[model samples]
Target: MGLIVASGLCLALWVVLWCFHIAARDAAMISFSLFLVAAAVRTVGEQVRQSNSREG
Candidate 1:
């Protein structure tokens, strides 16, 4: 949830920067967005593993 929220904020900032002609900042926002996505994926994977272990 936190990761998703952060990604959403990053997406907003990216758009804002693009609109204002701030090309350099876009790189940072893009990286942050990617990081958030990776973190979210890892979090989901951990939850799945925990659930599977409990069921097994």
Candidate 2:
């Protein structure tokens, strides 16, 4: 969904900043990464559940 895309973009931005040595503080980046990971996990879980329901 849009959230997944947004999180992915944020992560990409974080990586780019890191490579350029202009990233924010470690805590902020890590927090963003964690939130993105959580969103991804939830999205995947929802997809799987939907697929299983359809199959049933």
Identify the leading candidate in terms of lDDT: 1
lDDT score for candidate 2 against the true structure:
0.91
lDDT per residue as tens, model 2, 12-36: 9998978667445766789999999
lDDT of 1: 0.93
- The window of 10 residues in a row where model 1 has the poorest summed lDDT is 19-28
Show where candidate 2 strays beyond 4 Å: 1-24
Q: What does each candidate score in C-alpha RMSD? A: 17.6, 18.5
Q: What is the Cα-based TM-score of model 2?
A: 0.57
| Cα-based lDDT for every prediction | 0.93, 0.91
Clashing pairs in 1: none
Error of 2 at 33 (Å): 0.2
